[model samples]
Target chain A: MSELVPNKSIYEFYRLVEEHHILLAFQGMMTTDILTMMGKNLKEQAEDHIFHRRIFSVMVELVQNINLHSADKAYSESDKKMVGKGIIVLSTSADGKIFTVASGNLIRKSEIESLRQKIDHINRLSEEQLRDYYLEQLRAPEDQDSSGLIGVARRAKNPLAYDFIHVDEEHAFFLLTVPIHQQNSDK
Target chain B: MENFSIKGSNYIPTVHFDAKSGVLEISGESYHEYTVEFFQPIIQWLREYLATPGREIVFNFKMVYFNTSTSRRFLEIFDMLEDYQRSKKGKVTINWYYQNNDFDMLESGQDFAEDVNLPFNFYTF
Candidate 1:
C-alpha cells in the first residue's frame, strides 16, 4: 500500500481503502449536499437498497454530527480545521459479503467522556436492547442529537465494532466501525 | 392533505408517499444529513391520517436500506398502524417486502414484525 502511494495524506488513506475493499470514504469537510450524494451512491452500489440506505443514513447522521456539534471547528478548505473534524470510510471484506463502515473524528476533551459513555451504552445492548433504545429515543421529542450514535448501533444487524485514538490538545480521535457480518450469506 | 415526494440520493432513502391513496411506499437507500427534518412532515401526515383514515391502507416498504434514525421513524409508522388497527382494526396492512435473494431484508422485516406483532408479509421479487 505504501509503495503504491508514497504520500501519507489522501493518497495513502485512499489506497488503504482500496486495498481493504472499503466501500465509501467520507473524509474532510462533510456537508449536507455531499452527504446526500454519498447516499445516492450507496443506493446504486448496494445489493440491498434497504441495507445501503441505513448505512448511508447513519453516515449522514453521524458525520453531520461532527460538522454541526463538534466543539472544535476547523475553518479551512484543504483540510479540516474544525474541532470535531474526521473521516468515514466504507468497504467490503475480502469475501465481498461483510460490509465494513468506519468513521473517525475529533472530539472535545470534555465531550469525550460523554461520547465514551454513550458508545459503551450502545455496545452493551443486545439487538432487542438496541431496538428498545431506539424506540425510547424515538418516543421522545425530535431534534435530539444524542440518539444518532445509538441509532447506528440499533440499526446494525451485526455488532458494532469501535475504537478511540487520543490525539493531541485534549482531543480524541474516535473510530466507530460496523460489519454487515455475513460472508455473502445473503442476509 | 399535503402530498410530497423526495426521490433517492446517494446517502438518503427514497421517499414516495401518496396522501390521496393513503398508500405509502418507502424504498431504496437512506443516509441523509437531515433525517428528522426530511421525515418530520411525513410523520405529521401519518398522524393526520390516523385521525381520519381512509377505508384501507396498504403501507408497502421495499426498503433494502435504512439507518437507525430512519429505522426509528419506520417503527413509528408501524406503531401507528398497530394502534390504528385497534379501533380501526383490519384497515391497515404493512407489507415489509424484500428481495428474495437478500437474507438481511427478510430478517429485518421479521424483526420489525416481531416488535409490532403485526403480520408483516414478506414479499420476494
Candidate 2:
C-alpha cells in the first residue's frame, strides 16, 4: 500500500482559494438534491438579496449543465439516479467586487465543436439580440439535448469563458467560467 | 370546469387556477426534475379554459426562480394567451409580481412582456 503524505502543492492551492474568498467548492457527484441544498445555503449566506438570487440562478444553471451534459457519471444510491461527476468553485474577487462560478467536467470530444460555436455566437450578440435569441429558442421545438445555454448567457450578461482540454481521443474536459458583477450597494 | 390547484414543493411551483373567477396564479420556485411532466396538466387545463373563452383572463406570475425548461413552458402559456386575445375570446391581462429591488425578476417579466403583444403589469411586494 502506498503511504499517504500531505503535499505542499495542496497547501499552496488552499492558500490561493482562500485569498480569492471562495464561497463554495465541491468535487464529486452532483445531484439535483445537492444543487438545491447548496442553493438554500447560499441564499442564507448571501447578504444582498438581488446578488443572492443572481448567484443562485447562475449556480443552478452551471450545475445543471454538468448534471445533464457531463460525460462522466456516478451512480447515486440515495437518489437512485446517475449523477454527473464534476468540480465546481464559486468565488468572489479579491476586492469582492465580482463573483465567479466555474465548473469543469468531462464531455464527448465530438460535442466540443458545436458547443464552442454556440458559445461564440452568444458572445457576439448584444443584450437586445440576446433577448431575441432567448425568445426564439423558447419557441423552438423541445430538444432534451438542449442545455438552455442562452439562459446562462442572459443571467451572466457577460461573455462566457470556456476551454476544452484534451483528455483522450473520445473525451475532453470542459471548463466554463461565468463572472457576475456585484450589485452596487447604492443601487 | 372544476378549479385546479397544486401546492408548491421544493422543485415545483404552486399553481392555482380558479375556473369560476378566471384567475390563474403561479408562485414560488420551479426547477422540477421532469419539467414537462410537472407542467403538462396545467397546459392542458389552460387549453380547455381557452376553449370556453371567459370574459376576462388574468394570469399572475410570482415566481422566485425557474429553470430554463420551465421558462419554455411559460412561453407556451403566453402563446396560448396571445392566441386567445387575438381571437377576441377575452381581455387578457398578465400580472407579474416580484420582490422590491429584485431587478432580475423584474427584468425577466419585462423580457416576457416584450415577446408578447400584451402589456404586463409589474407589481412589487
Q: Which clashing pairs does model 2 show?
A: none
Q: What DockQ score does model 1 reach against the true complex? A: 0.32
* Per-model CA lDDT versus the true structure: 0.68, 0.84
- Give lDDT tens digits, candidate 1, residues A69-147: 6555666543233434578788877877667777777766677777677777778778777756765776666555456
- Model 1 chain A poorest ten-residue lDDT run: A76-85
RMSD of 1: 5.6
| Residues A1-187, model 2: lDDT tens digits | 9766679878988898888798888888877777778888887887887777777787887787887788999898766778788988899887888889999999999999998988899899998888888888887777643437777777887788999999999999999999988753224
Leading candidate by TM-score: 2
Interface RMSD of 1: 4.0
Task: Point out where model 1 deviates above 4 Å.
Answer: A1-24, A36-69, A73-84, A91-100, A125-134, A137-161, A179-187, B1-21, B87-90, B117-119
Give the per-residue lDDT of model 1 (tens digit) for B62-125: 8765655576677777888888877765488788877766665676677678778566677886
lDDT per residue (tens digit) for residues B1-125 in model 2: 99999999777899999998888999999876457778999999888888975458889999988888788888889988998888856788999999888877888899899998886999997
